[model samples]
Target: MSRRQRAASLAQGLLVGMTLGYTAYRAVTLAVNARRFPRLDRPHAPLRQRPRVSLLTPARDEAHNVPKLLQGLLSQGADEVILLDDNSSDGTGDLARDLCRGVPGARVISGAPLPDGWSGKNWACQQLSQAASGEVLIFVDADVEWHAGALDAVLAELERSGADLLSCWPRQDVGSAGERLITPYIDLYLLTLLPYPAMRLPLVATATAVGQVMVFRRSSYDAVGGHQLVQGDVLEDVLFAKRLKARGYRVLGALGGERIGVRMYQDYASSVNGYAKSWLPVHGNSRLLLSVALAGQFCVYTLPWMLDFPGARLLRVTGLLERSAVAWTAGRRRPADLAEGLLGPIGPLLQLPVYHKAIRRKVKWKGRVYEQ
Candidate 1:
């Protein structure tokens, strides 16, 4: 090879090495932290007696999932479960109404008409928050099914920790091949940015919350202007978390692991399109950064395989060590006999092109079309 080409290759190799090293370092830390801290599932007394909670769900054409979700909420020892129907044509509204009539302390309200420039889900949530009469407001999605103790456990965690907001990273159930490829990357990116270890410490101002399950103190929500603060944001959950931090509110986040679970997407197309819809917006509408991020994502996921080719597998060895180190440090429990490191090798490839298209196309979510 020519000297110039060799220099370029070496530079790429070094970049890959650095990325892998960082990944391993993060993984090891995450795993060790998991072992160090006791689990957060044990029972605790609610901070106050009979603390009223309004569990709000925003739904648009989520008829299929709403029933199960409502059943799960009813089983929870909460004060109320409120459903905000965002004008669904698919009988989601009717189903919600039925559940409301059947269950005590359950109510369904018609969401106000969508105003221009506002995301539908955010608008619906804002209306629900306004109507709710609870000391604590919990926003749980229609697709989420919680365990019996989820409500009690989460409330106890928030009250004990004195956090204004608490969000759980629910266990993701990926049934399709597409999900297997895409869902893991979601957690990977989350960990890369918001390390589990850092979450337990006060040094970092950074955090993230799954929209599937989020609980907020009524005061904290109003202080940050609630959903109004993130009206037009597609990634409202992240933006809401940011507002909480900005207002000097401590936000607590944890791995729900088996504690919570959600089936986010039904198929590959929806899964890919779902990410393309908000991944760019999450970075603040910067296409330039989006392009660069896509490139970096692919390189970090794929480079080790390329460099390890026609060789003594040093590059591949480095990649595996890096992956294992990250997996361990993330503190997520995995079977000792299983091999999950290879999944990351191709995970980004599945997501990068989808994001590229998402940046170019309009996203249709919750019966609204958003142009990129």
Candidate 2:
């Protein structure tokens, strides 16, 4: 090789070395702290009486998922359920009304029109809160199917922790490689950056949410001005969690593990489209920052595998050590290994196009299409 080529190779080797070292450090840190991740503590047999709990669901053209949700909430040990049908063209409104008709303390209301400066889900949630009378409000998405004791367990946690807000990151089910590669990235990002223990620290303010389920104290909800305070946010749940911390509230997040799980999208197209719908608004309209974020995700996730390729044999030695470290940090050997060594390379490739489309596409969200 020429002198310049030798120098370039050395530089690449050094880059790989630093990257692997950082990966190992993060992995070990994560594994050591893994025990701190939240778990659902089973309610004591003589269960502490929970406050009056309200199941607040915001639905829009969720007819397919609504039935399952209705069934799940009805079976939970809660005081009442309020389903806010957010102007569905499908039979969602009718289905909601019909399901609540004979069920005790169950009621459904058609949400008001979407006003200016308000994101759809937050607006719908505002309406749901207005109609709710329970002392504790549980925000559940229409897509989520809850188990019989889920609410009871969540309520128990809220009471025991004395937290103003409680949420859980449900286990995600992935059928296809697309789902596996893209879906878990969200979880990895969360666990890597917002480890449960760090979230309690005041300097920790990177907003994160398991929007599938969030339970809030009625007074705490009102104290932070509720959904109305966050109406303009596209990522309302994330914003709400941050706002709660900013306002001196104890915000607790649990690792759903297998307790709560949701199938977020049906297929690859749906998954891509779904993310595109909110990508730009969530990034504050800075495409440059968005590009940088995407690039960072790619490098961090894909670096290990690239090192293992035949042309990059030098990287395999470095990559394997780093992979071992990430595995340690995440608490599960297989997930961290696969995520860093295998999926890491492939995962970010899928995201680049999604970012491009998010910049160009006029997309539909919750039945309403918005032009970018």
Best by lDDT: 1
lDDT per residue as tens, model 2, 1-372:
999999998987776666556555566545644667665543324347758889999998999888888888888857889888888889998988888788898888888989998889989898888888899999998877777567666766677677788887665555565555455445555665555667667743644576778888999998777898788776677778887888788887775543465667777777887777767766776778788778755555566455452324544444344434434433334553355545444556877767978887466666676665
lDDT of 2 at 87: 81
What TM-score goes with each of the models?
0.86, 0.84
Question: Deviation in angstroms for 151 in model 1?
Answer: 0.7
**On residues 29-87, what C-alpha lDDT tens digit does candidate 1 reach at each position?**
55554554223455467657557998999999999899788888888868888998888
Clashing pairs in 2: 27-326, 27-329, 30-329, 31-329, 301-344
| Candidate 2 colliding pairs, count | 5
